[model samples]
Each structure stands twice: as structure tokens, then as C-alpha cells.
Target: MQGYKKETELLTKLLLEILPILKAQYNLEEYQSKDFRTGDIACMKSLLSRLKHLKTSKFFSTASSDEDLKLKLKVDAYEKTAKNDQKVIAILKNKEKGLEQRIRELEKANKEAVALKKSMERKDEKLREVMRYNTVLKAKLEC
Candidate 1:
């Protein structure tokens, strides 16, 4: 009886671990396509088959209600994980948009700075020319 209990516990733990992995793998875009790896599918199928067998076995029958309760817990866990992931994705998307806007603002500021620099250079050249003309007129008057 103790051995059977241990076996059931181990099986439940394995199912819990495998559920998350399967969820993650299946959720991936690459795995959603027809080109998904056969090996992963085969492995998941076998694991599910074993889990089904364990669930239907007489050894686990006495605790069938416990198994059902655990299954419910698993479902709840998966749902919570999915919701948290969505929240994180939304936050990251907002952050990305903010960064993009910052980049555009920085680019516009850079362009304005460049134009201002050119304007200043032109003003400096004009001032130098005026000084040269004033010097030439003064020399002519002295002559």
C-alpha cells in the first residue's frame, strides 16, 4: 500500500512537471506549425498514455477524488501562469513603444542641433568679413 501511494505521488509530480513543458512547447510559434518536431509529439503522447493508464488503474482508484482535485489545481496554476505572461507581454510592449518614441525625439533634436550649428558658422563668417571691410576703409583714409 505504501509502495502504491509512492508510485501515485511520483506519477502526479511527473504529470505536473510535464504539463508546464508541454504548454510552453505547444505555445511556441514554431511548434504550432505543421513542421513541429515529431520526436516531441511522440514523447508527449507516450507520457499522456502512461498518465491515463495510471489514472485508470485500480491502485489509484481509491484516491480518484484526490487525483481530480490535483488536476483542478493544475488547471488553475496554468491559467494563472498564462495571465501573468500576458501582463508581462503587455508591459514590455508599452516599454518598447516608449523607447521608440524617445528615439524619434532624439533624432529630431539632433537635426535641430545640426541646423543651429550651421547657422552659427555662417554668422561668424559674416562678422569676420565686416571686420575686414572696416580695416580696409581705415587704411584708405590714412593713405
Candidate 2:
């Protein structure tokens, strides 16, 4: 009777440990709906294939080890940081493009301003010449 009791206790402990892992592995929240589309079926198949691969992978075997778990956590952290860095890079590229466009617009405006200033200078010179001619004509008339 004591032997049977010990076996039952061991079995109970094993089940307690295994049940949560199974629940996590087979989480079906996404597939709870009755309405199944073709895409959903394809996605389910893909997920099953990945699960099978994961079960056979070395990562799964090492998951129970403390050192491997710590390494996995570090890898996850680095991956998150990499994603944030990529987002920042994308934002900076957009800002650079905007600044470049603004520079081009300013350059065009500068060109137009220079051309207008040259035209005004030519008009001023022509006005001075006309005034001098008028003065000469007035002096001759007086003579």
C-alpha cells in the first residue's frame, strides 16, 4: 500500500508539471471561432509545422537548462533593441529626405531672388541714362 501511494504521488507531481506546458504549447485562442476560412486553415497548418519543428529542435532540449534560458533572454532583449534601432533609422531617413527637399526649395528661391536683383539693377541703370539725356536736351534748348 505504501508503494502504491508513492507511485500515485509521483504521478500526480509529474502531471502537475506537464499540464501547464501542454496548455502553453497548444493555446488555441486564435482558433476558437467556428468560422474557419481557407487562410485560417493554411495558417493553422503552418503553425503545426513550426510546433513540430520546435519540438525536435535543440532549443527545446536546452530550454530546461538554466544557462540556455539566460542566453535566450539576452537574445530576446537584443532582438527587441535591434527592432527599435531599425525604427529610429527609418525615422531619421525620413527626416533627412525632408531636409534635402527643403534645401532644394531654398536654393531655387535664392536663384529667383538673384535674377530679380539683376533685373532691378538694369532698370536703375537705364533710368539714370534717360535722366542724363533729358538734362542734355534741356541745356541745348536753353542755348
Most lDDT-accurate candidate: 1
Local error of candidate 1 at residue 63 (angstroms): 11
lDDT of 1 by residue, 1-143 (tens): 89965665564555555455445533422222222222244444556565466566553454546556456546656787899999999999999999999999999999999999999999999999999999999999999
lDDT of each: 0.64, 0.62
Q: What is the lDDT of residue 135 in candidate 1?
A: 99
Tell me how many clashing residue pairs each candidate has: 0, 0
Q: What is the C-alpha local distance difference test score of candidate 1?
A: 0.64
Q: lDDT tens digits, residues 5-119, model 2?
A: 5654553443333333433444634432221222244544554465557656665556765445445545655676789899999999999999999999999999999999999
Lowest lDDT block of 10, candidate 1? 28-37
After TM-score superposition, the amount by which residue 72's alpha carbon in candidate 2 deviates from its true location, in angstroms, is 1.2
Q: lDDT at 139 for candidate 2?
A: 98
